[model samples]
Target: MQELQNVVSTAFANIVASGAIEKAVEEKLQKTITDAIDSELRSYSDFGKIIGERIKQSLQINFDTLGLPGYNELILKIVSQQLEANMSSALTEHIQERMAELLAPAPSAIELSALVTEFIKLETERAGHTPTSDEFTLIVKRDTSIRSMRFEYVYLDPDAYKSEYQCKYQIRIVDGVVSNVTFNEVDPSKKLFIGRLYGFERRLFQLYAAGTELILDDETKEISTYYPHCD
Candidate 1:
């Protein structure tokens, strides 16, 4: 009987050492946790709805403590107002500047003398001539009866070493402005007198001979002649 009891005790010790019971318990606990999670997931939409309702109720209860509009709405409103204010200020400034320009007086006749002087300089330069201050003379004549002005200038070509080549300009001005400046005649033989000019300068003179208008900018002091479909 004692041997039988010892044999039974040894069998129990072996079963415990094999860890079957502990493994079964662990498996059961894991299965229980998985099933619980699956069930909760199946009802997750409903759970979220309920939680969202509770949170909305809490916010409503504390509405007075917080602001009327939410933080996002308030920030958006502030940003919108600032943008509108900036745009309005810019528009106002632009309108004022335009109005001032519209109300400004026309440039005076004296201011136009500079235009004549520039014309003479550009023409002389185009003719391959640089005249000293003493070698050139400008005569401006205003005819109020015809509402026109005439500019006459004579210059001695500095490039001519063999003989003094005297160049002359007669510019007509109407309405206190001049748009087109051209030679009295387009003599291909004049190239011989002026020597070879740059290709661009030759083209410019050709266009002037062809009756293209010369565009002048008073602000930038730029002179350009118009050529169709050309820069």
Candidate 2:
């Protein structure tokens, strides 16, 4: 019974020894793995820095070989040129349009004799008098400062076989509107005779006072007496 007890004790001691050896090996392996991981971690920052520098140098070399500006400079130059081109095109177009408008021809003036004849007819009719053919001449003068016009009419002979007469009229224009008109007979001595021959003075004043547009040609002494006319 003693021998059986000793054998059992030896078996237990062997089992303990084996277990201790396995624990020691496991601890050594864990320490070695931790050290290796730490070393790799410590080198990661330097590896990243070396790679970054190499990439930077390679980019710089490529830019120099291609004779190209830096990215930032290139982008700025492109943007500036684009803006300048657009502005120049727009300005040129604007100037061209303005020059075209300025170079266009002005409207032609109305014929003189035709306007005077029409005016005489309308005025005499309004005054309840039959229009008669009378020889007359018109002299036009322009005032640029006041934007006004003056007209002088000399009648060759009275239709009623009376003395000759002269009439003058002044028209003031403001902002394309006929603001005021003045009429006078030059020969007051022949007033009664002029009145009897053509009662057109009062009618002329009325026609202009009622918002009539008068287009006159200073160069040719002609006037436009019709509506739907241009200045």
Candidate 3:
């Protein structure tokens, strides 16, 4: 009887082990779960991409409709060019009006300019030559025009010297064109003065040619700077 019981128990164990009643294996179940999770995670990734694209579209539409500040540099440059092109004539007129307003000196300033002009002319005539910097004691003490803008005018008479300032310049401008520039500073010794006069005349002619607008370069930059105009 003991042997039969052992035999039956052994047979039952063998059958169970041989997969007559199979159950899910741990490794296979784990693998299935992992695959499902991976699929779900991939879908989530796609969903995130969709959300990002939607956000981008929404922002672009808002920017266009509300005129918000996207492409700010490009927009500003294009608009400036358009404005300048379309309103060239009107812009010139507008600029001229503004310049007139801004450049309109006070009554006192105008009076001072007139007096200085008269004084210089009278002094030159009285002295029979342009006055030296030291001789215009009152003007020298009061204003720096003589020192600052001396290059704009003929050379000063130094210690009653006449020949040094004798060279004369004749410049004619019509319709903003330098039709003629005549000067007697032909001697090699006076070439430096001629060069200076050339620069001055170039500026004067360019200012007239530009007419309410300016072309920026090394030569014309000072026109934009704040300089004390003796005139």
Candidate 4:
């Protein structure tokens, strides 16, 4: 066993000294991993073309017909109404379904920008002076349960937050009306603070709004976050 170990060690040492291991790693892994990383970093930019193609193929409606996205639903409704008479009800309903399912979802990445804007707006209001994006930063975290109540006014119960964040809040978020989701009469317990929520379609997210000292710098400390893949 001792002799065998020595022989194996000597062989490994020779392989290392000859640069075979380094050559093998570079040839096999390094370029592949670098490429994978590059692709992942660029994936966000591809979202537009991929989604545009999907909408174009599925809806067969040119976005050039409807201008910006803000009035898309309204404009689509009018366009659909105009074209509805030409098409069957079944086809009309299918387009509506596609609109609801695909186009209605505003991904969390979009909301992150909006969240920063909202924060800046509020900070400006509170301090009576406007601060630059460099003034303060946001800390986003995936919340399994409702943890931050400072921003979430109605969702006070930590125990019920799990059920609401998972179930009821999910329902209210339909059609991407994420300005500030409030539970009026449907479920008294389930309401979402738009400021607190920094989430994708299904997952729940919360930004640190209460006590954490906000210092803005993407160049310095990369904000720690757990974001699920956009579905």
What are the root-mean-square deviations of the candidates from the true structure over C-alphas?
21.6, 21.5, 18.5, 37.8
After superposition, which runs of candidate 1 have C-alpha atoms over 4 Å from their true positions? 1-8, 44-231
Ranking the candidates on lDDT from highest down gives: 2, 1, 3, 4
Report model 3's TM-score to 2 decimal places.
0.19
Candidate with more favorable, higher lDDT: 3 or 4 = 3
lDDT of each: 0.47, 0.49, 0.42, 0.41
TM-score of each candidate structure, all chains considered together = 0.23, 0.26, 0.19, 0.18
Measured by TM-score, the strongest candidate is 2
Per-residue lDDT of model 3, residues 1-231, tens digit only: 999999999998998898765544666788899987676556357765677677788877544677555698779989999998999999799778755643344221112233234434544444355433333311111223555331122222222334423523332333223334344443322343233323223333333333322111233212211112332
lDDT of 3 at 67: 55
Superior by TM-score: candidate 3 or candidate 4: 3
Clashes of each: 0, 0, 0, 0
lDDT of the structure predicted as candidate 3: 0.42
Error of 3 at 117 (Å): 40
lDDT value, residue 195 of candidate 3: 36
